[model samples]
Target: MFKKIKYGKIEVRSQTLVLFSAIYFAFILNLAFWRYILGHVQINNFANFFFIISTAISVVSAFYIFFNLIIVPFAAKPLLSLLLLFSSIVNYMMFSLNVFVDKDMMRNVFETTTAEAWDLVTIPGVIWVLVLGILPAVFLIRIKIKYLSFKKELFSRIKLIAIAIILLLIQVPFFYKSYASFVRNHSEIGHLLNTSNYIDGTIKEIKTRLNSNHKFIRLDENPSLVLNDDGAKTVFILMIGETARDANFSLGGYKRNTNPFLRKEDVIYFKDVKSCGTSTAYSVPCMFSNLTRSGFSQSKARYMENVLDLIKRAGYDVIWQENDEGCKHVCDRVTIENMLERKNSPYCRTGYCLDEVFLEGLDKKLMNIKKDTVIIMHTMGSHGPAYYKRYPDRFKIFKPTCDTSDIQNCSRESVINTYDNTIVYTDYIISSVINTLKKFPNLESGLLYVSDHGESLGEKNLYLHGMPYAIAPEEQKTVPMILWMSDNMKALDYINYSCLKSKAKDNDYSHDVIFHSLLSILEVKTISYNPDLDIFRSCRTRRFPY
Candidate 1:
């Protein structure tokens, strides 16, 4: 029985408080973890039932041990309250969105802007936290703790820790095969473990930051531009799209006409393309670096020379027009024009801007081109759970759209419709860029649009992306890549457009192709340029015209 303090606060012994807190966390805070285990592991026999019981006991023991080690006499209630509140939010994210929190996902969380964070907030989320997290936390904070003498408390804690460890270890021998098989097959199960997942992710991210080398390795210091003798200025636009998946695109044979504008344009839509990573924080830098997806490291990539650096060294004026999040340090050395800062009346809103913000003064800039230039326009296309906010009113072609951020509450039809509308708007943005490129016929203008990564909209109960790459669904991996070339650009590189189109249809490509393909398209001669990875290399009639 609990003793009543002066302010009606329940006074309990430290050991009792720790035990109750651990039980609360194990049973209440770990719904997703228990759900995953139950769904994946069958309990057809008594042995299976015993395994489940053992697993539950082991989890509770683990929590008990963890709390005993971390919770001190003075900070016990405050610490438990905070953990409960945070665990609730994490649980909501995992249960509602079906996203796995890993190191890269933590990096995404750290790098997320205020506006981006607000997009994930919803009424249901608040209510869930209030009921399951805040109320419990308030109750925990109001509890008073009665501790024993220091020596006795220490002895008691040590004994309890020992007991918990024995409880955790005793089950392993009996269910060794079950444990081994479950762990081997369901590696992603670790991500479902609530407090452990985010805590592990945060620690790994911090360690990466501490261990990463600050000095950048220069790939090519003296790369040269090998322009055609015709003396026409080459204006290549690299448009980095966000979250636009091929499955929703009409160009890739989706039943929905999500690409009405792109269908009319003579662009080569590469149907089968995979992203470097499932998150923007990983994929954007990985695609720009000379390193292939297998070889890429974000830590190394931040300090290393990217394609933009080589292009700048090769004597072309390079500008990064960012409308999405930060360029992930890919455009660090280049001239960056944050389009979101422009606040153009037609395109700009409270904190974010439309993709059309990139097109505002594009024509004038192209017309006044004084030299060969590469303009990298990063667009915020189809980023959700606020899919309806991505596009304008006119581009809401898909009917009965999901307008709220609580997309879990929305019907499947409405969610898909809302997501499809964003793609349609993206189609308009890309085609508009192509049209802008067409107006500047004197310049050898061309455009390459590739999404950083794809998205998930309630597919297999998964919502937004950031699933670990190894276990990610095809919805989060298969992105759309489109290329548009002017007649002048075709002549400049001696590229057979028909041949490229033919290859685009049947051939598969990934983000690894971007670095080398950009070099090929820009006529940049460097040792880092791998002709083998270049998608346009086979279509070119001649090599670099140096």
Candidate 2:
């Protein structure tokens, strides 16, 4: 049985080598896939054996199905070995991180900069890749093969395929109901299969991005605006908040006073607002683009300028102050100040600048603009698992906070406490921005605070954001939005001040409103602007203020 047998150019040591290799590879390499199915599918006493046999058959049959479809006929032994080794590496990463590979994660991989890549490098990651990927790859590359005739090789391959199909066919009648139910109930299990997840995701990402580039229809070649500007210079500030969920916001009626400062102010809090996507990489650009959430296309968004660009075209000086990684290319043509690069600033510590750092020289930046201006402050708000690092020591009001970046290691209570503290700190930051804007009373100033997306706090064993939007929990989609305009700013004739009071919490809104609302408020007239999607539409008496 230990003897080597040859079939064409391929060599197998006994037929047992082929059978054992197929079973071993399926079971070992797909541990994550198996674990997911086992946890999700119900197993009654009588159905237990049925599920087990069905799963085993599915794995073995899938292996042969793909092998005969691709590897057997097309790939030589060496190439097939390389592909297997590469897949093992991907499996190790996914299993260790508890991440599901989907289009968004693939987008993240392609969009990841060098600085962001460091977060993924860890001791466990290194260990898993070495044990699961490199060792297997070395063995495969070093192995030798014996040869046989082409006819014999084809016969052997067909025989193996036939056997796998027969076994799968036999299981269908006995366990068809259980198998169908499991697959239907836990559809995501297919994405966890080794190599298939990333392969499918990558292909999608590439196709979407490629098609997305040429789809942009310019909003306005030369935008014209009618300012409700009285004697004061119109100043509009947009705060792009990060990873903040409405469930944690005190303004949204959360149990905690996470937004104590903002609550004290006249913030028109929008209660029912959902994000376009679950990741910053997707949400940032989407929110700023002049496209409705329902009508939005990633392919089209990448090509056009956003609300900021339209505001600039309307003759306002646009400045972007970034404390996060970036404004996701929305600020490319605008004047940008990198707050995180201000290493000498007090807000800079531990290779990251606190959200307050975004305000360091805001007053001076404002002074340079003689014309009406729009300033965007993109903050690193409540981004975890380093929740403790987000706020200053004094703002660590939530006691026994989770200090470690590894959130799962901490108790769920501690995670919530720490995360809430970050929200409180964010409140202070927003209030501070409002206070600073107040100092320039002569300027017609207003601040609109909206988060790119929301976060999940260990709900149902899910620790973070970026679950596919279609199936994501409400906690990951619902975000907090606040608008505060100075009395002078609200006096803009086109803005119906009554609407802000009436629609503060009653209506359902989304990132769809951001684009149209900004254009309406700024009084930028363009063909792309749709009043129907604007939250302020009912309040506006006219498109332009005389």
Candidate 3:
């Protein structure tokens, strides 16, 4: 039996019922945080349980006090219930995926293609939402909460607020070291807190996108390139790869021959190359901009006219062919084509296309090319969690591969086999592009393949990518970079093929090199070019040699 309290104009509900209800909701909702803290922190004795319990109580009491203010005045019980349900759903998905709800994840939600989004839907995810979110929400809406008068409600809120403050204070001494360490080492833990996570992500995304959308200052003026007197036409192809890790490629000394085709194509593979960021959204724009990893920011990258623009300004014809998402505004000022939109292409499947699809009209596209030209191809190489869908069935050489979108549900070996098959397919695509380049014998040509970023494949219990760059694992930062030049292009004394080959195996490179390397190779002269960041700078022993 619950005791009812008297109030000014309204009948007071059972005080015991209200108190227990708040406690129950708080305890259940904060379960994930408690588990995370318990697993991470060492337990010396029963005092550890006290700290953990106090932490959960503090969170719950805080929520209770805040909800009391709104629920009494605005009849916001349904609103609070809805918020809890929404947060529960978000938390459930994150728990199932072993992911944190952060700004980058929010960006992915916003920018993902239809096919990619469909890949995220699974029976397990649905069950998680139903068990954690919908079930609780249904019970919450069904609960009967009696209203007290304004005066009595206000008094009750004050009492609860006092209790919450006291409970929070109790945590100070017991959890000081743990709290400080967690805040220092795992600062992003704040982004995992329910409701706050999505709120923070939304705010940051809005502010960052607004800043990026503003007009940017131009980097170069009157940029130009003077060709050698030999009058050889230059054709530079930049292959922008996606979600490709160096560790998985045979060319990078991996045990598997994932890059069998590229390995035999006489390509110069650059080992130890790191990315500017850990996501395509960050890395694509950063790699094209005249900014080093230290100087990079999404806002700045969005505003600046990148290496391609400067190359175009220097009188070289530039075009971008994309099978992946749009170029992150990198090709805004250049000629650009998307393969997915092209009709009658057998390579297009379920609203997405493979990397090779972009090469269909290549010969016709290059028939009237300029003396100096640069073609950039952006690939959808090995994008997950549907790695099996990235390539054709014929390329599924690795048997027992994970064919489902739920990569985590599959065995580790199957997931890896699926991923490796995608790599092998990518190798084939790159080799095909090389063979296409060989068709035009009259022009001096070169191809440089650089991934936007690397991927995580069940390493440290992490899968996929979009991790923060500073704390990202080596798999997410180290990417494959391969280069190839036609015999005619390699013959130039100043081009220095030997020098490039000599350092290709040992030199350390990053996305920072991309901007300047393109400029240097294209013979573009500009004030913004930094020779130090150019990978070819050491190789160019005779810049003036004709």
Candidate 4:
């Protein structure tokens, strides 16, 4: 049978090999193509390139193994295409499951699957989950399995299809999330290498450069500008917000009265603050890095050092508190990120908990601190899917909660209202923190709040965060930036406040300034600090040393 399947001069197996090779070759080309999409040189590390190559090899090898072990014996069967299509479905299923399971990865923080997932009581999501898992697997099986029959019957296939439907009923979520992440990460290349995750490896290289650039000021390296009346106490708090939109902020001058509290306060608010990107996956890492959003995504991670790491080294008492599942590895090196976060701990919440949960332990943590403090509170404000999850029950300021993840079921107004309510809660939390600073007698206290990234509440076809940078909406790119400093808290001889205010108020600054701004405020010396990178440092004389 294999002998008759020759085309011109080539045998069937040779033909399959050639075709498979071509697909994988295209995968390699896609790696280069990804760089073009970003319009930058992809200076990926050795591991990144290795990842691409390995992924392509793994997929091809899997196909080969399946074909040789199972499909070759069933060559008489004509169910190959159906099998391939089925596998695509399963891929989607696994992808969904993975995303939902890895709380740190996606919307993994839910205590329970949202009510929207249920279709009538039958659970339409079960059907979806199965389809996501079963289809691709069926295709893969069909491709490699050897089907033999003296005479094949067309009508008999009906039973097979039914069987497939039944199988899909059992395994959707697992299949969906796995495939989705694979594609989302590498689909830009449209190649088989996605199975290997080379794209992420490349992304990591650039992250190093970004982390290296994350600091502009270190507190211990320089004395606090704002001194208490007694002149013996010191205090500093860095409030890292999560997914708060600039357009929704009242202080940032969003037409909506989103941030009424900040607007009223005498805070140094940046009217034109721009996040490096639209998604937390990209933005959080970028915000803590030296590079701008564009620059960080392409640079090498090995070359950078995060601001937090430096603060700890500078002998300041570093603390990391969180009300969110938050970013992975980003906070790994911080002295305090572990003590405060509930990620892997027995914290009742998953990806998101209440803002009050964060506010609950706020006072005891900060009062009576010894050395200068670099406290970073990673909030769970405004994460999507269940937009209402981030705020407390009382702070459900937005009416008609669009608690369902399915946006089509909810009106745009309902979703925004719920999200804004969360933002309002975030503002209240910030206010409480600021108020705490005012009362604390020890140190000059300051609050710098920047959201990890903005989100999409169903604008155009964009559902949530993580839209590719190329097509991200303005809503996703713009973010709220507020610096609340007490009257006495000013860099004594460092730089001009008016200049910093003017620069920050404009939307030109990206995550690049975060490092320098922190360094300037903390007085930590770092070689990576660039006045040009700092929105406030261009006028400042002394530069920070990393």
- Encode model 3's per-residue lDDT on 1-546: one tens digit a residue: 333345423232534445654665565554555556767766777767666666677667776665655565335556766766777667765565556667877776777778777777777777776776777667645555565676886787788778877878877667888667767987766755666677688788888887676777799987888564557778889998889999999988999889878877888999989999888888999999887889988778778889998999998888898788778889999998878887679898777887779678878765666668899999999998889889998999988999887888999999999999999998998888888888887777889999989888999878888877767899999999999888887765366777788798868889999998888878788889887888877787666211
TM-score: the better of candidates 2 and 4: 2
How close is every model to the real structure, measured as TM-score? 0.98, 0.87, 0.90, 0.63
Model 1 spans with C-alpha error above 4 angstroms: none
As for model 2, its CA RMSD to the true structure in angstroms is 4.0
Tens-digit per-residue lDDT, 245-355, candidate 2: 999998899998888898888888899799999888889999998766776766677788888888888888898988776777789889998886787888887557889
Cα RMSD for candidates in order: 1.2, 4.0, 3.8, 13.1
After best superposition, candidate 1 residue 126: deviation in angstroms?
0.9
Candidate 3 lDDT score at position 538: 76
Q: Would you list the C-alpha lDDT of every candidate in the order shown? A: 0.89, 0.77, 0.78, 0.55
Off by over 4 Å in 2: 1-25, 45-48, 64-98, 138-155, 169-185, 213-216, 349-351, 493-499, 540-546
Candidate with more favorable, higher TM-score: 2 or 3: 3
RMSD of 1: 1.2
- Pitting candidate 1 against candidate 4, the one with the higher lDDT is 1
Model 3 Cα displacement at 369 (Å)?
2.3
